[model samples]
Target chain A: MKHTISVLVENHSGVLSRITGLFSRRGFNIESLAVGPTQDPEVSRITIIADGDEHTVEQIEKQLNKLIEVIKVRTLTKDECFARELMLVKVSCPAEKRSEIMTIAEMTEAKIVDVTLTTVTLEICARYQKLERFIEIVAPYGITELVRTGTIAIQKGSETMDRKK
Target chain B: MKMKACQAMVECLKAENIKVVFGYPGAAICPFYDALMDSGIKHVLVRHEANAGHEASGMARMTGKPAVCVVTSGPGAVNLITAIATAYADSIPIVCITGQVNTDQIGSDVFQEADITGAAEPFVKHSYLVKDPNDIPRVFKEAFYIAGSGRPGPVLIDMPMDVQKAEIDFEYPKKADIRSYKPTLKGNAFQVKRVMAELEKAKKPLICIGGGVFAANAQDEVVKLSHTMNIPVITTMMGISVFSDDDPLFFGMLGSHGVPAANRAVNECDVLFLVGARVGDRAVRTPLALEQTTKILHIDIDPAELGKNIRVDFPLVGDAKNVLTQLLERAKPMQHDEWLAQLESWRVERKFATAKKGTVVPRQFIDKLSRRLPDNTVVVADVGQNQIWTATSFHIGEGGRFMTSGGMGTMGYSLPAAIGAKIADPKRPVIAICGDGSLQMCMMELATAVQNDVRVKLVVMTNKRLGMVRELQTKGYNGRETAVFLDGSPDFIKLAEAYGIRSCRVTDDRSADEAISLLAEYDGIALVEVIVDENEATL
Candidate 1:
């Protein structure tokens, strides 16, 4: 099972390592992670995607909360939050095959960020499942490179995992 | 007033009311030493940076306050890792200051440069790398506060050499108020009521304690709770000295090396109130099985520890003293005479046979030696079988302390820790009990003791081998022993003589009795080397 843990931490230099170090030390499996400054300039929000069962995920949240810099930790389920990951995929497309690849990109709502004589690069930002689908559709065209900014999430409704908690 | 960052660091210590520090100096940290010389605080120069750490740990464990240790960069700071990890494992409060190379040269790996804060991140409660000279006061304040606060542990502050020399307008903070670091002190009222309800319904109730009880200074509250409710108490290895083994309601330590009575009581207890104990594998070999049968209500300052090792039935996150006081206030007079009688029936006392003509039994010697010491004697036990012997055999009377590297089980802990314990309270009797192998590991510290004029008693049970590992080989490895023998070990009596410390070697019952009296009565630092049987066992 995959669990998304949203953590609010002090916006300090070493706070990220404190969270990563804890995950590594406790042997928790981190599938993906993304951190950015939050609404308050002094606080940062880290979205961690970890692979664990119900018990292990609970343990992970408890352990994360132990760090002195961590202000809040909430294990958001897929239903409770909206998640997004921006990915860039470069395909080896000759001039002749450009139209076919462009058609596929247009259907997937991926923007053509860069283009060259021999290759084409498209950028997409969507939920994890949509990103995977885009990659599958573009794989036939021969992907030369692919990179992803691991999942970042926010609450679906007015609820927020901020210092207010 | 404008002052160098290093001077401000010393001022911060003075503000915390620190009287002394243990450290070893090097090039990177010389500036701090220079500033310390005029600060009116005594500095004990430890032989090794590692010993400095252990010594500070000893002080912290004794005083219930965060103690300080300083060392230089690279190897100097690296050497203190063992002691820091040991303190982290046992939840001892210590503020470790290490000097880094020039701020610009830190990552270039210049001479004596090390990323100590990065290296110690996993072991420390929190760490700070002071880039700006003005951050010294705030960092020092936060370091001390974090090190001594809820679920206390070591904290590291790595100061760059250039930063230490930079001048800053000094203004020490009166209090630490980190936004994300507030600890829950009082127990939840509903949870406290829930625990009381469980206590009322439990037929076989048991209370298990750990080092957290001492950290919280809640020994009185725990004892009061036990007596008021007539509930039996058991302890983990770190929880020793909370109650003597002879106390009618006090059961022995639990886990792998624990007594049969305490382990059985844990098995039979319907409600096990675990306070401040981590329930490590050694303390509870099979937590799952016990959780299935027993209702475990765990109260610890660190919420992570509640269900880290076992499945907790009711988890209460708060300081041990405050939560225990809450339970005490809401308690009703109750007794479990039948439960106490059943636990008593399960108790089995071991009787050791007398020592042979020229070989003294280590356990028997410890038993005799402990009886002669004062009620408040501080006993520091090293790792391996010597720790087991002392933990199982030594009787800790009222106000006595039994300090050990329980969680980390590090070797060579006793000698330096005993010296630090003595430094904390000069009037109390402090003793370090170690095996021959463990003694050799820290034997260098005898020079520190003699140089500082710290009168600490040392007892070395010399079997010429690492007895614990040797015993394991004999039992589990087809009796093939390897690397367990101390083939080139120096005679401890002669070593003590070289250090100009009074010492004795006991070989038999008569000599053991005489040496015990001599070591106990000696006003100066002393060592007693007792030759034991090669195959002596630990229970």
Candidate 2:
């Protein structure tokens, strides 16, 4: 099972390394992780997606919370949270195939950020499955390069991870 | 007043009430040492950088406070890694300060430059690499606070040479308040009530303690709880000194190499009150299986330790002293007469096989020595077969201490540790028992002992083998023992004498008795080399 772990940490130098170091040290594998500043400048939020059983996930959550810089940790499953990932893809394209790729991008709500004579670069921000499907349809166009900000999530409804447990 | 960053650092140490520091000097650390010269804080020069750390650990364990160790950059700091890791593993609080190359020299591969904070990241509770001189006082305060606080462990501070030379306003923080680092000290009222309810219902309940009990200085509170509720108590290896061997309510140490009664109590107990123990694999090999039959109520300072090892039915996160004190307040007398009797019945005296002629049996020797020592004696046991023998045989009565590198199981630990403990309290007798293999690892510490005039007793159990590994090879590897021999070992008695310390060699139990008396009665440092049968069992 896949679980999303959201952690609030002090926005200090090496805090990111400390969180990532903990995951590797405890033998927990991270499938995807996204970290950025929160509403409070003093604090940063890190979202980690990992695959583990219920017990393993619980252990991971506890271990993450053990880091001195870590302020709070909450683990949620995909069904309970709204998760999204951002991807930028640069695909090989001639003038003939450009319109065809644009239609596929239009269907997925992806934006064409750059247009070159032989390559078209597009940016897409969507759920993990939607991004994967978009990649599947555009793969035959000879994709040249791809980059992604791995999965980040927030619980659905009025629940905020910012509140103290 | 404005002063060098190094002066501010020394001032910080004085503010922490640190009267002594164990360290080895180098060019990078010279500025701090120079500032320390007039600060009235004593510095003991150790032979190796690592022993400085170990010695500080000894002081910390004895005083129940964070002790300090300092070393130079590069090799000096790198050498102290084992000691740092050792202290971290055992939850012994120590602040390790290392000098670094100039700020600009870092990452340039300049001479004597090491990223100590990066290297010690995983082992330390927290660490700092000071780039600005102004952060000196604050960093030192935070380092000490983090090191000595809840679930105590080692913390590191790496100061660059240029930064130490820069001037900074001297103002040490009166109190360290890290917003993210506040530890839970008191247990929840509802959880305490639940624990009480469980205790009321448990027929074959047992209390298991660990190193965290010592970390919290909660030995007395735990003892009170055990007595108040009439529960039998067992301890993990690190929890050795919490209960005396003669305590009627006390069972022996529990683990793979644990006392039969203690192991059986763990199996039979309906509710196991795990106080300050993580229940490592060595303590309970099959935690899941044990969890099926036993309802474990674990109270620890670190919440991460709650369900990390075994399943906990009642998890209480707080300091051991506070939680146990909470339990003591409303606790009433309860009966486990039948259960106690069952445990007592299973507690059989272990019989030792006869030793070869002209050789001493370790267990018998330890028992005799323990009896002869003073009540306040501190026994520092090094790793390997010697540790097992001492842990099983040493009688730590009231006021006595049992110190070891239990969690990390580091060899060559006892000598420096004994020196540290003796230095911490000169009146308390300190003895270090180590095997020849382990002794050779840090025998250079003899110079440290003699130079400092720290009169610590050394007991070398010379079995001419890495006895623990040899035993493992015998049992598990079809008796194929390779690279287990200590063929080129030196004469430890002569070695001690060369260092200008009194020394003796004992081959049998009779000679061991006289040597023990000499060790205990000697006004100065002494070394007793006890020759043991190579095939003697660890148990």
Candidate 3:
């Protein structure tokens, strides 16, 4: 089962190491993790996608909450979250295949960020499954390089994980 | 007027009311040592860095305050890893400060540079790597606050050499308000009432105590609740000394090495209210027995501990003292004379096995010592057979303390930890009970005891082997003993004398009384080495 966990932590050096160290130590398989500055400068939000059963995911949530730097932790079900992953892929493209590659990029609503004589770099920000399908379509053209920003997520509604006084 | 970062650190220690520091000095920590010279904080220079960590833990356990340990980076910091983890496992609040290489040279593989914070991340409650001098006061304050609060544990602050040298206007924070680190101190009224409602109807109720009871200073409340509700009380190994053994409702430790009566009570109880215990594997050797017999209501300060180990029917997240107090208020007096009588019968009928002649039995020796020691004495037991023996047999009186490496199960913890306990409270007698193999691990701390004039009695159970492991090997491998014998171990009495402490050796049960008296009557540091049969097992 796939679960998305959102962790709010104090913006301190080595805090990330502490959280990731816990995941590895507890043998939790993390599929992807994205951390970025939040509205509060002193706090950072980490979105982690992990593969585990319900018990394992609950253990991870409880363990993550035990960290002193961690302020709050929430396991966002698919229904209550807006999740996305951004990927930049540089695919091998010849002059003749450029139009076909461009059409595929357009169909997926991806942007052509850079282009060279033999390569076309495209950036796509979409849901996890959509990005996976897009990558599958481009793989035939030969993807020379790719980088993913992991997954970032937010609660869809007014439910806020703000630090309660 | 600028001050050195080390000076600021010393001043912050003073502000935190840290009068004693257990530490060792080295190149990276030179500046801090220099500043400590005139800082008025007494420094007990331990022989090994690991001893410093245990001593600090011992002091913290005794005083209910965060103890401090300072060491240099690299091997010095590495040496304290075991001790730090020991404190973390038992939730002993200790503030560990390590000096690092200069900030610019940190990643350059400079001399004496190691990522101490990274190494200690998993075990420590929190860690800091201070890059700026201005963060010194805040870091120290936060370190102490975090260590001493919310299921207390060890915290580390890695001070870079340059940061400790930088000058800044220092102002220690009056209070630590870490916005996100608030711990729930009071139990929710709804939950408290719910527990009370259940307790009112419970027939065979039992209260299982753990280290958190002592950590929260709720021993009195635990005793009061047990008496008021006439509920039986059993403790985890770390929860020793929380309840007096003489109490009618008190059962001994409940776990793998626990008495049959305590384990039986755990299996027979109807409502098991666990206060401040995590129900670890050692404590719940047969979880199936507990699950089948009782519905567990776990009250703990840390939410992470609620459902981490076992199934909890009800959880009241609050400080043990506060929650226990609330339970006492709403709870009505009850009588379970039938249940109490059943437990008492089991306690009387199940007697531990006695030792054969020619062997100085560990349990018999501990029983005698328990009878002879003062009511306020503190017993620090090292790991292995001696620890289990003491836990099962030794009786702690009111106001007495019993400490051990319950979580990490670190050997060589007794001598240094006893020294720390004695230093924290000189008015009380402190004893360190260790096995021969365990004693050899950190016997160097005998020098620290002598140098500081720390009057702690060192009792080495000289079994000539790692008795516990040897017993396991004997049982599991069909009596094949491997690597369990200590053939070249030094005589502990001679070792104590080498450190300028009085010493004696006892070989029989007849002489055990005299040895106990000598240890009790002596006014300064002393050691009593008891030679026991190597074949005798802990159980």
By TM-score, who's the top model here?
A: 1
Clashes of 3: 0
As a whole number from 0 to 100, the lDDT of residue B515 in candidate 3 is 87
The list of candidate 1 runs beyond 4 A from truth reads A163-165
Q: Which CAPRI quality tier does the interface of model 2 achieve? A: medium
lDDT of 1 by residue, B1-539 (tens): 79988899899999999998999999988889999998999899898889999999999999999999999999999999999999999999999999899888878978877778888888998889899999999889999999999889999999888999999999999899888888899999999899889989999999999999999999999999999999999999999998865689998899899989899999999999999999999999999899999999999999888788999988898999999999999877897999999999988777888876678888889988999888889999999899999998898888888999999998999999999999999999999999999988898899999999999999999888899999999999999999999979997888999999999999987888888898778889999998988888877
lDDT of each residue in B252-297, candidate 2, tens digit only: 9999888899999999999999999999888999998999999999
- Going through the candidates in order, their DockQ values are 0.85, 0.74, 0.73
Task: Rank candidates, TM-score, best first.
Answer: 1, 2, 3
lDDT at A90 for candidate 1? 95
- Candidate 1 - CAPRI tier? high
| Backbone clash count, each prediction separately | 0, 0, 0
Q: Which stretches of candidate 2 lie over 4 Å from their true place?
A: A76-81, A155-159
Better of 1 and 2 by DockQ: 1
DockQ of prediction 1: 0.85
Model 3: lDDT of residue B41: 94
Q: What's the TM-score of every candidate structure? A: 0.98, 0.98, 0.96
What is candidate 3's local distance difference test score? 0.90
